[model samples]
Target: MIQVKQLTKRFGQTVAVKNVSFSVEKGQILGFLGPNGAGKTTTMRILTCYIPADEGSASIAGLDVFENSLEVREKIGYLPENAPLYPDMGVIDYLNFIAEMREITGLERKKRLREMIDICGLEKALSKQIGQLSKGYRQRVGLAQTLIHHPDVLILDEPTTGLDPNQIMEIRQLIKEVGKEKTVILCSHILPEVEVTCQRVIIINEGEIVASGTPEELTNKALGGQTIFIKIKGPKGEIDSKLNNLPGLVSFRKSSEEGHNFYRYEIKGDGHREHCEDLFRMAVDNNWILSELRMEGASLEDVFRQLTAKEK
Candidate 1:
């Protein structure tokens, strides 16, 4: 449970975040996206109370982030892009220190420590000094410290950085599981990970929110029309004629011509099944060999680009 209203922040002459407002419901995993210098981290820092906003207000779990900064920190597990860690401390010792700092003690502290080790896959590196660990291990340690307190909210920025593919998937699944009971704000440059891990998305650009919605909703909205690719073996003139007359076919263009009368075409239409069905039936009726018929839809990456790309 979080809410922000007209939040604004500035550094020197540049505004890092401008009149931005959004909310995340309890148990919801939100993907916070943006290109470099687009204010994603700025927003998260404000929400986490790491810095004060120049204007506007924000609250988490019903407590004002500014007024109750300490309490808010207690309720949130924040893994910043560059994790603050002590390289001299062993993984287990550093985690213990964090547990104590979080006020967890005795049996509960031990329980949390073991849970973090297992959940973060730090069992092998328990005795290793943090500096001796690889970057991936260091990331795991950062995640462990963040979750050691079982906070109600998680603000993770690039939580999977330096992790191998297997480690990435493991962390991804762990985030999904944690989101079932905690509010999560995942900020990352990896679009596919966000597409699958986040239930909703908010894209910020030039310090303002450019788009916000479910992944599918954003993609569908970005798509002005359906794109279909088809390859057919037939007389080029006859095929073009039939395609032109097909109902709901917004437009078609021959992309290339292969040998033996086969041609590839790019079709744009309203994208209803009827249009595709009509094309299939047309090919069958004309006895034209339909070698390929596939549809392409806008992806999260496409939507991100469409919304955030700058003009020269």
Candidate 2:
């Protein structure tokens, strides 16, 4: 539902985004990830038509964002990092104002307002002034205004930034539910949240597209191969010799030596199950006590660091 091609943007001599390109299919939730000053917000602004790119093109549902700015705005709901809100207005009144601005009136507006209140869990705060609400509730109000128009695409930047753990989970679940029907572009610094909430990911660094794929795919790319952690009780020399001769053993290192001949080892290899089996067989044959044998795969955070870390 969204497409960007060779998108580049600059402010003075600084390049905010360079040759960035990616696409989101209809009903897909894409996670846009980057560290601070990585042009995440700038790219979102351009996609939402809040700003124009200096070079390349972007389109929403085939409508050029630059040429058809107004039309593109109609199809997108944008909740910026800091939600634009009026402190003095009551939650319901603010939603009503947004509805009016969106040309939603009468029965249609009423229905949408009711739906947003329920969907955003804003029933108790409707009568309260926005400024009086907690950060979580205030965020809900922002989301309500964004959804008031039922836009096809939702561009949310740090939707759960300041909320407690419970509030973060609630917002994540809400976004997951909304994503079933609408295409979503979610920008978050929280890697775990993105891994759970988004179907695919795009990582940008230094204003360039660094990586793009499913969370698992990116994790595998970062890890290169599987890692196995094992804790065994045996003679150090014998254990080392067995591990060194194991098939598919890429690398092995003794992590620590505990009391009573127990040792912890980290082993890296190509075939995951094959290596585990070899370790098990060796432990049994050598009468070694195997306490822990587990596979450790790369997490989204690992992938993020691997792709975005500064060059040495």
Give one digit per residue, the lDDT tens place, for model 1 in 1-312: 999999999999999999999999999999999999999988998999889999999999999999999999999999998999999999999999998888899999999999998988899999899999988889889989999999999999999877788878888998898899999999998899999999999999999999999997787667665788999999999998988888777789999989999999998876454556777888999999998998787889999999999998
Alpha carbon deviation, residue 149, candidate 2 (Å): 0.9
Worst 10 residues of 2 by lDDT: 269-278
Give per-model TM-scores. Answer: 0.89, 0.90
Count of backbone collisions in candidate 1: 0
Per-model lDDT:
0.91, 0.92
Model 2, 2-99: lDDT tens per residue? Answer: 99999999999999999999999888999999999898989998999989999999999999999999999999999998999999999989999999
Index of the highest-TM-score prediction: 2
Model 2 clash pairs? none
